[model samples]
Target: ITDWKLQKEGGAWNHCSSSVNHGYLRAVIIALYKKGFTGKDIAASKIASKSTIYRIIKNFKESGSIVVKKASGRPRKSSKRQDRLLKLIQLRDRGTTSTELAQEWQQAGVRASARTLRRRLLEDGLVSRRAAKKPLFSRKNIRDRLIFCKRYRDWTAEDWGKVIFSDESPFRLFGASGKKLVRRRQGGRYHQSCVMPTVKHPETIHVWGCFSTKGMGSLTILPKNTAMNKDGTNTSSESNFSQPSRNSLVTNNAFSSMMEHLAIRQN
Candidate 1:
């Protein structure tokens, strides 16, 4: 026997362990055969099953080694480097379709199917998902939003609690809201393509509502083509009610004024 010893715990070739490497089994069988051990004696040594030992011995006699040779067949469509390029394309534009990605990747010197491209992206931890819808803001709008956030950054919860926030929105009565698909990795919630952009005003019925930390305040449907006056009143023929109080912190086109005028006249 050789000086090589096997650890009894969690080691193969010791007390009939099942996790024996093919090379190790082949070496053991050859070693035992050279030592004048019969096939039956080698089987009893517990290195491998009789069938496995005989097959390995036969292969060794014919090929001189137990290493598996590469199979002869068609080559892969995309190499590892090409697969990485596909991933880069996906990261650059998550909204790109698999077919589109395949088309783009062809320019990079690789021809592959869309399914294959998707598989490569999946292997790299990219998944196809519906992009989240977000309100689109212009550069000026974004700057104003940042300024607003910073101005109120230090406000306490109590201070915010007293503030009433209001907004006007339109809901489509007869139209489908389209959705977009995107491929993204984990923790990419804020990616540009991963978010759906919403316009400032969509063509639909305009409704106004206001809420506070205390509770909901008012809900009103604004009339179509209604315009505000210098006193912040909706100057439509339907909105001819009592004039607004001068003490009201009004705007030429403020939301609270429209909501209040609608609410008072409805009662």
Candidate 2:
């Protein structure tokens, strides 16, 4: 009919796919009725059932509007003030938990459920949780670090070039020594079973050396028998143990002896 073609062009029939837009069913029934189409014909057209079409026509004639009345249910717990309070909490204390926000709001005389606050915060574009990293040092630690910077400020280029930078780090032979699973919640107990049996492998050691502008020095592997005392002093046992065999060792020492042999050959 004329009305049916008009509605198809106006995109009114598209709303019928949604339960929330059931009001569009009324418009369809009204258009069919105005074109002198009977209930049987309307039902046969598959727009809606006979009873649904009748109800829509009756409601449309009574109310003059196509809006369906809201169904009765449990009312919203949060008021406008509570919504604004939720937004304020998010803006001021982002990444806070719903339970914490609920408790704080309760103390402020605006009692709301944690679930309600959480829903409101999400609706207001605020994420419910985040992982925050606490800084390792404080302002006092930063201020004290300036002492090292000041001590190195006046060094000449040659002095800076001669300075060595070295640090020690533990090397695990079997890879990482600790558990790898991460737990998100605080105080949550994690499974502590060892994934692999711990076994001692051949000990490995690394020594790195570097100078300031000239770049790194050659790496020297230390003997496994080498050990440092508790006070960082080298013990005599390690010194003697690191020495080469009698045949390889020279009285003049390898470094000076090699230099002398090279000089004698050049002469």
lDDT by residue (35-108, candidate 2, tens digit) is: 78777778776666678977777777788767778789987777778788778876797766778889888866
Instruction: Tell me model 1's lDDT, rounded to 2 decimals.
Output: 0.63
TM-score of each: 0.49, 0.43
Native-referenced Cα lDDT, model 2: 0.56
Q: In candidate 2, how many Å is residue 189 off?
A: 10
Q: Candidate 2 has which clashing residue pairs, if any?
A: none
lDDT of 1 at 215: 63
The CA lDDT of each predicted structure is 0.63, 0.56
Clashing pairs in 1: none
